[model samples]
Target: MTETLRPPASVRLVRIGEEHAGQRIDNFLLTQLKGVPKSHIYRILRTGQVRLNGGRIDAARRIASGDLVRIPPLQVAARTDEPPSGAVDAFAERLTPRILIDDSELLVINKPAGIAVHGGSGLVLGIIEGVRKLRPEARYLELVHRLDRDTSGCLVIAKKRSALRSLHEQFRENAVKKVYTALVTGAWNQKMRTVDAALDKNVLQGGERMVKASAAGKAAATTFRRLRAFQTATLVAAEPHTGRTHQIRVHAQFMGHPIAGDERYGLSERNRAFRQQGLRRLFLHASRLTFVHPGSGRTLTVEAPLDAELQSFLERCP
Candidate 1:
C-alpha cells in the first residue's frame, strides 16, 4: 500500500471509544495522525493545541471512552518506503511454522532469537509487523508483552481489542505465571529460592536505560530452582513474581550466579569461556507460561521448546 500524507488544513474533533480507552493521549494522537513526527506531537500537547474534551491534558494522560479530542492542524511527511510484496510473503513463510497456538482470542508463537517484537529504533522489520502483513484480513493484532531482541520465547499476540485489554489487566494484576530456563555459571546449590530486590533503571550516555539492583528502586522478586548441574555451569528454572525491566537477568546476577552468555550483567571472563565453548546467544529462554485465559477463564499452560542451538551447547557441556 502507498503511503499518503493528509493535508494540514482544519481543526478536527475525534471521540474516543472503548477500544482506545486507557491509552496514553500522545500514543492515541500518534496513531490517529500517523505521519506526524513525535516531537511535533509533544510540542502541540505542550502548547495546549491538543485538548481533551475542551480541557488541556498532558501527554501522560490516559484517554477515556466518550472523551473528545481537539486536534490542531499539522503537517507530516510520508514514510519513505513500504516493504516489498515478496518481503511480506517471506516473513509469513518464516513465521508460520513457529506458531505455537492460535485461537479466536490469542496467537502465541515461539519467537526466534535476533528478531525484535516490534519495529522501532532503527529496526526495519519485527514480529508484530510481519504478523500484521500476513493477516491483513484480521481486524486487530497487538503484542501482549515484549521480549528482549535476543531472547527467544513463547510470545503472545492478542487477536482482538477486548482480548488485548483483558491480557493487560492480567499482567497488571500479577495473575500471570512466567517461567524461564537459563544456564548460569558455577553450581547452583539451592533447589528452590527467591531473590527479592528493588531495581532502578538509569539512562546512560547514549540514552540506553540499564537496570540495576538498588534499594531505592521498584520492588522485584524472582524464584529460581536448580534443574541440573554441569562442571562449570548450572541449568535452572526462573520464575519471576514481579515483572520489572531485566528482573530475571538482574536477579540472577544478584544471586552471585550470573547467567552464562549474558554480556550485559555476567562476568566477562565467564562469558569468554562460554564463547570458547561454542555458546553464542544468551542462555535464557521463556520456557513456559501458565495463565487463565482472559476470554474463557480456562487454565492454560503454554510451553516453548528450547532452541536447537542452546540444546546443542548444553550437550557439549560437561
Candidate 2:
C-alpha cells in the first residue's frame, strides 16, 4: 500500500500545549507536518515561512505553551510504502518484549542491536515510532539519549516533557552514570585504567560519519576495567566521563584494540575472523545506567544483560 500525504490547504495557527513547550521549533514543525521532507522544513524556517506569535522565528527557538505557531501551506510528494505494514508490526512486536521498565514518566528498554533509536537517515520506522504504535494514547514520547544502531543495551525514553527536560539536564551536567560492556580485538592491559583522548567527528564525502582521536577535538575520556581476557580477545567494562559520539569505540581503537565486530573502526581481518566464529554484530553494549528519577527524586539504576549471542560468543572465546 502506498502512503499519501495531504498538506493543509491554507495557513493555520496552532496553539502550543505544555507538553510541547520546550521543544525546538524545527522539531515541533517536523511533528506537526508529517511526511514532509526534512530539508523542506528547514527551508521554510530559513525563509520565514513559519512564525511564532505572529512573528518570524528561527528553527532553534524554543516554543512555549500558549504560543501561536503559524504554519504555511505546503505541497508534498506521495511517499511509497517503504516499510510495509508487516515490517512495522514486526518491529513493534520485537520491541514490546524488550521493554524493561515503564512508569508514568519514563520507559526504559533493553534495545536490540541493529534497530535505530529513532527514524532517520533513510529509516522509516525505529524504536520511537514502534513505541508510539504500541501506546497510541501517549501524548509525548522522546528519546532522552541515543545508542548507536549496532550497539544494543539499556535505553531510556521520556514519556513527558518535564521528564525529558530533567533527563536532558542530567546528561548535560554529566550526572548520569553509564556503563558499557565490550569485547575488544586484543587483550586489554590491566594497568591502563583510562583513555583520556579527545575525539573529533567528521562526515566524509559519502556521508559516513567518522570519529578520530585528535588534539584539537573536544575533551573525552573513558575508564576501563579488564573483565576477562582470552588469548586474543578481552571483555571489559567501560565508563565514559563525557558523552561523545562513539567515544568508547574510538578510544579503544586509539589503544590499539578496536572493538570486535566494529565495522567502521575495527581491524577488518580480526572482524572477519570473529564473524566466522559467530560474532556478527558490534561487541558493544550499554550494560547499565544510573541517574535520578525525575518524578521520584530517587536514585535509579537499570541494567541490561548481554544477549544470548554475545554471551555465547564470550564462552567460545579462547
Candidate 3:
C-alpha cells in the first residue's frame, strides 16, 4: 500500500526584498499573517498543509531566497476566542504595586512569583498579556527580558519594534545590567564567586524548557557576591553573565548550594530546611535592572523593591 500523504498546501514565494531572505517559513507567516494564533500555525504544519519546494517542512526549517512556500488554506476562526475583556480588566486591577515604571517606549513591571511572564502550555494568562490590556492601542509590546515563572522582579516591556530590537542588541553587547537576589543553602567561603557551567536539555523526552548540565550544551556563566549571611543560608546578589535557561539556579546547584526551595534544582534536605523558615517558592527575584533609555538615551536605573515575602524574610534573619 502506498503512504497516503495529504495534498500539500500551495503557496508562492514572493520576493519582498533582501530582508526576508533567510527566515523560516513559519516565522515568515507569523510576520505576514499578523494576529493569527501560534496554535493555528502548528496545526497547519501537522496537517502537512505547508510545503516548501514541493516537500513538507517543519516550522523550524529555514527558507532561502527564491524558495517557494506553499501555505494550505487555513480554516481559521472568524473571531479569536481571546481572554474576556473583564479578565484583562481584573488583571490590571491586580497590578497595583507591581508596576515599576511606564513610558511611551517601555513598561517596567514587578512581576510576581508563581505566575509566568507569558502564557505557555496550560497557563492561560501572563504578565505581558495583562499589560497589553492597559495599552490596547499600541502596535506591539514585547518582553525585553524574561524571568522564570517562580522568579519575580523587574520585567521590561518594549512598546515598539525599534526599541525592542535596539534593547535586544544592548543585551547581546552585555550593556544591560541585571541583578537578582536569592536565598541559597549553605555558603560563606568565597566573598565572590562565579559559576561557569554548560547546560543541556535533559528535555524529559517531551517536556519543554527542562534542561540539565551537559558538556555538549551551551556555555553558561553566573557571578555571585554575598550580600549577607544567614544561619543556614545566604542572601546574595546574583549576576548571570550568560542567560542560559536556569543559569543562576543551575549554578547554585553546581556550587552545592541550590537556591532554597528550588525543588527542581535543589536538595530535599535543604528545601525542607527553608520550608521551616517560611520560605515557599524559589527564593529568587530580579532586584535591579539598568540600561540606557531607548527614548531619551539617558542612563536609567530601575529597581523593584522586594515583595513583602522577601522583605520579611530579610528582616527576621538573625
Q: Who wins the lDDT comparison?
A: 2
lDDT of 3 by residue, 224-275 (tens): 9999998878989999887677888888888888888898889998788677
User: Model 2, range 149-252, lDDT digits (tens) per residue?
Assistant: 99999999999889988897798789999999999988787844889999998756544669999998989999989989899899999999999989999999
Better of 2 and 3 by lDDT: 2
Q: Please give the ranking of all candidate structures by lDDT, highest first, separated by commas.
A: 2, 1, 3
In candidate 3, stretches whose alpha carbon ends up further than 4 angstroms from where it belongs are 1-84
Cα deviation in Å at residue 93, candidate 1?
A: 1.5
What lDDT would each prediction earn against the true structure?
A: 0.83, 0.86, 0.75
RMSD after Cα superposition, model 2: 5.4
The superposed Cα distance between candidate 2 and the true structure at residue 214, in angstroms, equals 0.7
TM-scores of all predicted structures:
0.82, 0.82, 0.77
Q: What is the lDDT of residue 206 in candidate 2?
A: 46
Worst 10 residues of 3 by lDDT: 1-10
Backbone clashes in model 3, listed as residue pairs: 11-70
- Best of the two (1, 3) by TM-score: 1
